[model samples]
Target: MGQLQLEEELGKGNYGTVKRVLHKPTNVYMAMKEIRLELDEAKLNGIIMELDILHRAAAPEIVDFYGAFFIESCVYYCMEHMDAGSMDKLEAEGVPEDVLGRIAGAMVRGLKFLKDEMQIIHRDVKPTNVLVNTKGQVKLCDFGVSGQLEKSLAKTNIGCQSYMAPERIKGESTGNLGTYTVSSDVWSLGLAMIEMGLGHYPYPPETYANVFAQLTAIVHGDAPELPEERFSESARDFVSRCLHKLPGSRATYAQLLSHPYLVEDRNRDVDMVGWVKRALESRAEKQVQQQRERNQQVLEQQQQGYQP
Candidate 1:
């Protein structure tokens, strides 16, 4: 590794900024995430934890952490560069059904790697944390809010508000969050799928006050009304299973990969669902209008007969 020529700023976060850099020696592009370690000791610890976990995870779906160094109080981490950028970018461009299926498969594989293989719980599994490459391959990123579970029951609030599992939001662990389990990640993954397809947070609130109120409701009430039929049937079912309110009811990553919707050609199945739903909705509206028109005609006929 030689001098890295900084080209452009990729992104910025609360604790750090990621910049696109070209290594002069290899002429390869990489992302350099620079974190100011001295800003807050607690924040620094979180970054360090993320770095350590990423290093421990050499799985294919996880972006490789190449190297790291400290310049004064600033910590810089060099990781594999994704040319295609984040899932948010893909969602903005509108992904096709096949591409969405591929993405879903990749994410489930990543979750399997994290949960079964590494035993690391990725508390945050949102779309923004998933990166895509030129080949449309998806990689999981951003471990700042992630934590390794040691017990079977965890009673702490973590992860992004929108992606947080219902139990986690309540800061009450009715399930096994103490140990690194895939259930919590599955819930977040479902939210990620919804966000990617919808182009916004599924449970977005009008204001911050509304957000808290909604989270509280989510913790105690049923899951939000997910716009499932808006996507393919397979995709809808996959996400629906992931969003199951009970953690144990959610599909495991491996189970998701083998799901009929993910592995098979579901063009006919999904399309039929889409077409039929729209037709039924339209027919219902037409029937209502026709009933009103029939009533009006009857009223006019009665009035005309009386007048004659």
Candidate 2:
């Protein structure tokens, strides 16, 4: 159990406080999340399962778990230091529509990677669990509650109430009534994106239960209200598809990447491909300008020395 000097408290959650740490040997910055595993054998098994799932889900858009170790009754996990912070921080700053779409695109890509490539269900896909790097690229984190989908319709009681699918709330004994599957994660993702777009989680109700009730209504009733045509029709359509009550009817991850919203946004509007290309072009042009200046400096030096 190596102890690194904790500089400042980065954030807090149900598990415990995460702090900024300086790895004594490498002198590199990292976020150390201190969590306790005080569970019995069954519960401990669940934690191990989560770790296994995260280990196999090696995606760039998924936060890299550097290492994990235990020290005197507590377990700690080290991860990359996301200097830009979480999506919650971004929401606080009130991101613009273009930026929101970019975030959404990054999130979708990460989820798609998990679902299509790794065959894992995040279970939790809210903004609070999404980390943003300095480049504004979003990565999905927090696999503590995620698991593998056993069937098209699943019955489970894991996940935040606000983001839980309608089927998950039904009686467990009803068996398939809770037939929410990996697509439920997509639903949560859509809701989270909408929250990012609006700068709020869209539950104006008084209590947490009220928030659940509101979500239940939307899940069963009419679609949620829009933001005065703020989102593109394609984006809206993708969201609608994600929130569909029937798990089988929801679009898969591959379908989501090829979705008109993501396709058009990346090809024509603001998105990762366009942003990265522009950044590379800008960097190349700057390098060329610098080279020209350096060549001029060398020529001047040569001319100045020749007269002497």
Residues 208-284, candidate 2: write the lDDT tens digits: 36544665665576545336557667667877777777778878777887887777667655554444345345545
Over all chains combined, what TM-score does candidate 1 have? 0.72
For candidate 2, what is the total of clashing residue pairs?
Answer: 1
Per-model TM values vs. the true structure: 0.72, 0.75
Worst 10 residues of 2 by lDDT: 149-158
Given candidate 2, what's the lDDT at residue 179? 61
* Alpha-carbon deviation at 192 in model 1, angstroms: 0.4
Which whole-number lDDT from 0 to 100 does residue 60 have in model 1?
Answer: 75
Regions of candidate 2 where Cα sits further than 4 Å from its true position: 1-3, 145-161, 171-178, 207-212, 268-308
Q: Can you write out model 1's per-residue Cα lDDT over 85-113, one digit (the tens) per residue?
A: 77764464244455567677777878788
CA displacement after TM-score superposition, residue 206 of candidate 2 (Å): 1.9
